[model samples]
Target: MQLILPLILFLVGFGAYEFFETRRAAYKIAHRIHVNGTRGKSSVTRLIGSGLRESGFQTLTKVTGTYPKLVMEDGTEEEIYRRTKANIIEQARMLRYAADRQVDAIVFECMAVQPQFQWIVEHQMVRSTVGVITNTRLDHLGEMGNSLEDITRALCNTIPFNGVVFTSEQKMFPLMEKIAKKRGTQLIYADPETVTDEDLRGFRYVEHRDNVALALAVCQHLGIPREKAMAGLHQTVPDSGALEVFDVDYIPYKRIRFANGFAANDPESTILVYNLVLERFDNGGKRIIVLTIRDDRLERAEQLAEAIVQHMPCDYVLLVGDSTDRVHDVLTALNFPRQQAISMGVASGEEVFEMVLDLTDDRSIVLGIGNMVGKYKSGTQIVNYFRHRSHITPKLEEETRA
Candidate 1:
């Protein structure tokens, strides 16, 4: 009886998945576009969706950012999944749902986890009208083969034969260019830098420039007017937790928050954020760095800690996660101030925040970073709370109007 019941449940799940797959495949044939990259997939997807809407197109976006946010044509936001591994069947299922609702186009972000999945999901399942590859960076050391060749091959496999590829100049750009040409898909660069300061309302970060360029290039190809496309650029805001800074006054000191989640996906990114850390907060008083290294990527743990110490003069360090002791040792060994480093092992995000809060006086800058959002799924909310509290408005309305 136990065996029979288990088999029945398995059959039910399989059948449901198969149903979703078929429906999703049909939806793809109807309105298909695929965007894949190491970073900027979520931001670029959101930017593209917003741009399309400003141009009066019906759009549905399946976002696989640090979290899952699905944006419908009416600009409604729905929380889709809380757990990770948003599989190919699920990606297809979103298309099916979009088709039912009559969304004009479907924008999907491809997961580069098992790089080969890129080809199968995009080519065989939903083949795209427009394909995008952001930039190739060094992250994901465990699942992906160690060599850049392996990473590039897995990513390049998604070049669409029938669609255009809007990509950035990357280390593997030449190879990607070669593949796109061979497939006869026109390939172009997506440089955020192309969008001038006048187009964006307020202050801008360097990262958003390429994303803007990419979306504009793709939107223009679809025959959206270049002027309308340029106008939509005014509404752009930094993706949540991206390296944006805000100013707020709370008692003895004003707070500065660096939204670095976009810059936190990999060790090199983390190092870059730290470099920015040094550059921005030079001689800033009472610096408190609240950071967590994912238990999964312990390989980068030591280097990250060492990098933090080498780059920033963090007055006090609050470490979060199971690998705290190991990461702490790297800094302590370098004489990086043993008395200042504190660990919040296996603590909740709020708890970690409180620990930092207790340590923070009026004159401190709190830099919360690392691959926490992707790993913990709660990163954006926690980071968002800080942004909301410290003058970074949730809506980009004011800035857009500026």
Candidate 2:
């Protein structure tokens, strides 16, 4: 009965999508564009939109990354609330809005898993002049499967059959080329070093690599120069809630500090942060003290705790959340020495911060990972206290990795 319900829903949703696509193509389109990938789809969308505007064209862009949206040139914006089947109809509605503005081009983030999925939303989407595939990353394992190869295949859904397709320096482009070949789309390649697009120096110098580079390359192909592209890139505003870094400060600590990597959603990224903290803090002077899982992420809180216990020589473990006791099972299962780990029954960030403050002096480097990966803001409060109240500076390591 449960399966039958979903099937009925799919048929109705698919049928409505097809009808929208057919009505959508009636608008005279100057060109259509689509962008996709794991990390930078939204960033790439903004860059391409900026490039189009610089190239003497009116551009409308929709970014479906961490935030969902509808963006138009006159500087007005609206947030979209979508139902379970994903934002297909909301996307079609955006295209219609763009058409009304007579925008010369449209750039949108592509999240579907197959070419057929692309055909459904895009059949009525703007007539894209180009296609952009930002570099791929290992995410959405349950949906795209575990292997990198599978992730690449899923992202290829955004590449159109006949239009120009541009991909970043992704490791799996050769395989993507084969997919493009079946559709007759020639895969064009781009790199940050090429400096062909626009000067993108003003964008915090941090977010330049991942998806922004891919966007610049696509923008350059649309006829915007390196200088003009840079201007547009700088001129481009981060359409609000668009993955921004807000305050930065520092603290002298024998007590370690965590950047709250909890915002991480998948195991792959969490593992990377684990290695980073372990490698950097293995100085043996002060030990790594981590608040493994935040509140609201108690479901897999034990998994994160387990991973941390195995990979690092943790001085102590502070578990936060209603599921704090679950972590004890893993420690026992692994036979980790009991002297080093403890669950404090879902402590608040204020309590955690106070405990760490009372525990150490000015020599400890606290590594906070998996803060954002979960479903809470405990990490933010900790970081903010150190930043706005204490005023310490941290050398952010993500851009170097990017």
Candidate 3:
């Protein structure tokens, strides 16, 4: 009985301390924007924070996508290395960090997938003034749910009460509006059509128009002019894993263009970007598709294989990483040509680099997709190898000129 009493007292004291700490940090920041969605949360968080900073507000942004990063007010970013595995409690720590810096605003990407954790992050940790949902897609169905409605409900848990919310989701607007009404928050639909092709041309890298429109709406609501917000977006640094292109002339008399779309794991987004690349770069060369499969993400691999069989055109499909057997089965079932679809199995980045060189001659394009998580020849690692090789060519040319 005596020991139980002390333990209870300790628990009560710890709970009270955490409660007060969260509230104290929340009170320090005036504007907090919580970005939630199945995809594009990191990009939207960066865009909103950039727009706020350009409008003369001190903003701190945290993104838990691709890799975690803490974007500072001056547009520089530091990697957020976690001593332990990811937990929703990181949001609380970010709030405390922002409070310590006395930043004018905070933009945080929702890292939690469970509904209960999402609610805790929204109501307890952030208590954000603005909530942004980029879009709802069929990713993370195991944690969120299996259906689109379930995914919508899971994402809506972050909608702030009596606050402003924005989203570019087209099909789920009615459901989102109902949730906003229940929470006494105003929901605004951000139209991707508002951003024209000309506007998209402003970005340094390839980006979806819908994400830009969603961020623009939030910045406009906060009283920043649209033009200024766009300028800030133009200067914004894309997440490290964002879609990037690299041209490699590693082998003598051989040229290869690698479009790194490993981060877009969903079938819809993946296929869209793949088609975009094919259309934009009509080099009439051999188009090779690389799928970096993750053991835990077999469903994703299957879906991507089906999508590719349905629409995408490629000369070769190289499957790497763990659990690529399932992807191979799907392709075989779909009657994909045996010669065209080859399972390379798990390979190191350097090994894959050599394989890519062997597969292509002076004219070929390699499109990388699927999850970028693995030990040896992960998507990011392969992309980095090609990127580094591509850079060396320029330096060699510069030295030759001198």
Give the Å shift of residue 300 in candidate 1: 3.8
> Number of the top candidate by TM-score?
3
Summarize candidate 2's per-residue lDDT along 1-402 as a digit string, tens digits.
Answer: 989999999999998876666366425557678877765567678777776776677777787754577677753567777766464666666666667777787887875655456666554454456777776766655667678888888777777768778887458988999988998888988776665222434664324454566766776777777667766766566533233332222253343444334434345556665565445333343454455564455434656666666665556666554555676667667876665566666555677666656555554445554453235454555555444434223443332222
TM-score of 1: 0.81
Q: What is the C-alpha lDDT of each candidate?
A: 0.68, 0.61, 0.86
Compute the lDDT for candidate 1.
0.68
Model 3's TM-score against the true structure:
0.94
For residues 159-194, could you state the per-residue lDDT of candidate 3 as single tens digits?
A: 999999999998988999999999999999999999
Candidate 2, superposed: residue stretches over 4 Å from native: 1-29, 51-56, 74-77, 82-85, 111-119, 123-127, 195-201, 235-264, 267-360, 363-402
**Candidate 3 Cα misplacement greater than 4 A, ranges:** 251-253, 375-377, 391-402
Tell me the deviation in Å of residue 30 in model 2: 2.9
On lDDT, the leading prediction is 3
Candidate 3 global CA lDDT score? 0.86
Once superposed on the true structure, which residue ranges of model 1 sit more than 4 Å away at CA? Answer: 1-31, 81-85, 202-207, 236-240, 243-248, 253-263, 274-283, 310-313, 348-362, 374-381, 392-402
C-alpha displacement of 60 in model 1, angstroms?
0.7
